[model samples]
Target chain A: MGKLYVIGIGPGSIENMTLRAKEAIEKSDIIVGYTKYVDLIKTLAKGKEIFSTGMKGEEERCKEALRLSKDNIVSIISTGDAGIYGMAGLILELKDGEDVEVIPGITASSAAASVLGAPIMHDNCNISLSDLMTPYELIKKRIEMAAEGDFVISLYNPKSKGRPHYLRESLETIKKYRAGNTPVAVVKHALRDGQDVKLFNLDSFDDSQVDMMCIVIIGNSQSYIKQGEFITPRGYKL
Target chain B: MGKLYVIGIGPGSIENMTLRAKEAIEKSDIIVGYTKYVDLIKTLAKGKEIFSTGMKGEEERCKEALRLSKDNIVSIISTGDAGIYGMAGLILELKDGEDVEVIPGITASSAAASVLGAPIMHDNCNISLSDLMTPYELIKKRIEMAAEGDFVISLYNPKSKGRPHYLRESLETIKKYRAGNTPVAVVKHALRDGQDVKLFNLDSFDDSQVDMMCIVIIGNSQSYIKQGEFITPRGYKL
Candidate 1:
């Protein structure tokens, strides 16, 4: 039986890829991923057989990868951490008997936190606004609870052209529980080319600034902005 | 003015450290961190001035690193991601006017998730059980809310010799809202030399297996264990 490796490439930057992840890709005979992710590592896929799928084709992609893993080493790639909104779960669920290993990578939340000061230094919650797999009501409830608990919150897939109001609605729900002065950060393409980081207060945050690629971080009650950096204290008594 | 880079070395493995993190450490004239983390990267700190402190000495270490940054390029290292339960916040809080940059690394949650299968493939909450800085009441509240929200939960600093019952207490609180058969995974020293991964159900989980170095992940309602792997579904049609 052949082994399969689900690798998180870490925010589309070759520099961010862990040595283990890069080595797995190098050792694999077949490379499988969404087309965009495949393009991100195209230089490394030079001699490997590539199976690239489009968005919304995760199920088919996992099935294909598992089938290919029956007799050949396969490397399936995800942009950020494979276990976080990535293909690890789907592949595990679809695999019949193939040996699989998941190599973790730097997730966008941590990557964005690095870019925009330390906004997640304390307890935090990560929620994806994409209703494709989760219900909107459940997402709203999670957001409200996160706000009430005063947890630093990271929102993924916050907005797209089709679901433009989700980010605004989620922010409104958070505003109902959190103060309007709460510091907010929007980081796009973190650690990659054309990276952008923006800071705003909950009251002044603009929905137009976010998209599917951006990570939106809303600070907890104790979070503050200093010297243009957003930071949440780790509850340490200074 | 000198520059200070707070780098997360990613679970104490040279292979897990990002290229950027390694570059930052290599470019530094002084390296500062907790003694254990400093030891993990000791080979890289060969000719550089290394300043390390024991546990509970974070304040002094950060202050010393900041002081060194006045005339030297200093790299203050942390295990896992520096933005999560790491030294980035403390350094940012203590910075008066030094040029500081936080380079992200793979966090323990992602590393543990990778080892224990995809338990955090959806919305999740990370709460630290250590009450050294946070109030126990707040920690309990976060655990309760995370349970009620059915969010995949990662417990950091779950237990130590000084605080043995915190993990048990936190699990009990989760039991109040979650099913007893909920999948739970404990990963210790993830990606390190003595790595260990354990899987259990909520009712069968043993607290003695955890320590300060362990990360405990509690799966949501839809999570299940198959073939010794703990996985949470991404709410897909499959």
Candidate 2:
């Protein structure tokens, strides 16, 4: 007979949190998130108990959050809009007669795309390059399909510490359908103070420059870079 | 050598405005937007000269804002994310050696999608239904293709005084590829104070209930209505 709130905190900024999300977090008796996120909002955890865990501890995090929610108000935070590539799915898998609510936040991909000048204007698609659980072949297939479909591909999990070459591999797979001169945008730490954005041509971008916190948007054939802006036309003839 | 800021203020709240957007608006010498949006943030326009217009006056609004930027800091406001079906395109058409900076905000479709519990999770697409200038037949063809591809369709400008039955017509067209029981969600004044959300089966929704301020999301075959929440899978394996 308890309530659970699943909230997307919008990138890494506290100001990005919605009024409703702030109220939910304030009302919650316990807060659960990754150790980094919990540490990020230390000031908000004034008197509330904090449950923190390391990476890949998602399943355990959900179980503990749900168990504690039986008698207390609990909130689980996701970095971006919760539903897209966030904790919403995992929490749904663990739902057991609990009162749950999802408060959406500004998603990083869209935010990044916005700052980069409408890279996802129309006929765009997003594909993640992690391949942590999904096979590399499937990711390659999706990349091919996205390229053929002329989607402005938003690449999430582009690169990580141990898996540094994933972006290069994915780029290679996309080369068949996409021209090397296509425009690509890299947004790092979007909306979190030290935000950095760079525009690169597919043929010249150094794969070594990418990091996990970045979201890369690769433009389609028709996409153009005009005066440093990345634009993918929506096929509208206005 | 003046600067022009095209800021997307996100859904419909002051809090939804990014810190960067607030800074731009505060530092701006002139603010330009549609009347309703201008009314939304009159406080931000305290001493600045405000230029407001009606729908279909986008070109004029942008031109005036752009003209002012040649000598003063100017900003054009787009309600949702400016790049997605907003002023980014129009601004691009009018760019003339002016330093144009795009400050992205949250889009209404994503906000509505979040409220409806992820109707656009994994492999979904969004298309606007407003054909104010485009022919109805073209919009109809897009709807057919969307339905055939099983993409979650987000209909904007679905209904208004002169186009009251457009949504009804589009629904009938979608029936060719979708079943009568496909889930549909209507979100009015999304993220605003007086937000109203309604759930309906595709075949059972009342056409007269829709209006311009609403966004209708039609789910794909995998979409389901559970406890008044629309759930769409993003292909995350359990």
Candidate 3:
């Protein structure tokens, strides 16, 4: 079997992609990813056997990558880091003895946090609100625990058409443990086209501003807004 | 004012760095970072002026970067992603007005995770074991809460000269909420020279194997070891 490289393309921005990700794509005989994510980098992977599918086609894509890797060098791509809510797990689970390499890239948490200043400078938790496969009760429990931990929390898949109220409900659980003045930032399409970033406090943030593409970050108790940018101090005495 | 690019060099590997990070360094007239981190990329910015300091010199570097950015393009570097336990927060806090662009890179959490398979493929929490800035009590609380949430826990700054037992104590807290057979990955200097990756059960992992340079990733409830690789499933049926 040939080598299989599971790569992270990094938030749809060409510059956000790591050198390793570019190199894997360059060395690959086949490139695979979700259609939208692949569309972001298809131009760069020209002359390769490109395989992409729409959302909910992860199993299909992972299987294809595994089959193609039997005799060909293949690169399976994911947006952001391939390990964090990406395709690495699925790909690894499906292939037993394939020589696979997981090339890490810039994750969405850091990408969104960087745009809204340094909101995640300290201990942080990333919880996805999408309950597609996970139960809603477990998701709520995770959010509650994260809030109780006083962690800088990054909420992934904040809002979706199927679960529009999940973000608000998650915030309500967070509000029970945090002060209303806690800083919150909702970033849509971070580092991608049609990017929208807005800052507000826990009580004042407009939930309607968020969507499936948005990432909402709520600050810890010590985090505060300075110079119109949200930041969590790393125990600095400045 | 000239642009201040606070860049993440990504786990000390040139290939792990993002294109934006490399570009910022290439465009910089002055480069600054912690001595260890600056040494990783000094050759890349050969013609540029460089300023680096030992540990506990963050405030001085941030101020210098700010002052220098007023006239010349300055790039302040950090190992891994600058936004996560790196230099971006301090730089944003010290500078009142400056064109600062935070270029994200692969954080150590993901870098270590990638080396040990997909241990953090689910909701995860990152808590530093170092008490130089954060109190040990708070760090312990964060670990307990993360365990209660069943998050794939990534313990950063796991061990140091001052507190060698912190990792064991933190694991004790996690053990209270998890099974002793929970998968764990101990990665030292991931993606850099002398990289060491090891796997063990939560009950069997040796404390002596860990240090401040190591990252310990504890798998969540749904995670397991397959084909000698740790993986947290993404709710896939197969």
Best by DockQ: 3
Model 3, C-alpha of A141: deviation from truth (Å): 0.5
Score residue B176 of candidate 1 by CA lDDT.
90
Question: Model 1: which residue pairs collide?
Answer: none
Q: At residue B48, what lDDT does model 3 achieve?
A: 78
For model 1, chain A alone compared with the true chain A gives a TM-score of 0.97
Tell me the tens digit of each residue's lDDT in model 2 across A1-238: 7888888777777665665667788899999999987766667777899888998888888888888888999999878777766777667656777778777767777778767877776545556677666566766666665665555678888888877877887677667778889988899988777799988878888766678889998886767877777777554444
In candidate 2, position B189 carries an lDDT of 87
- Candidate 2: TM-score? 0.82
lDDT of 3 by residue, B1-238 (tens): 6889999899998889999899889989999988888888867978779888999899999999999999999999999889999999999888778889988989999999899888898899999988999988899889999999999999888999888888889888889988989998899999999999988888897888788889999999888999888999999888
DockQ of 3: 0.90
Q: List runs of model 3 lying over 4 Å from the truth.
A: none
* Model 3: docking quality category: high
In model 3 chain B, the worst 10-residue window by lDDT is B39-48
Q: Which runs of model 1 end up more than 4 angstroms from their true locations?
A: none
Evaluate every candidate with DockQ and list the scores. Answer: 0.85, 0.27, 0.90
True contacts kept of each: 0.84, 0.22, 0.88
Candidate 2 has which clashing residue pairs, if any?
none
- Model 2, span B12-83: residue lDDT tens: 687656666777889999999999998777788788999999988888898888888899999899887787
> Order of all candidates by TM-score, from best down to worst?
3, 1, 2
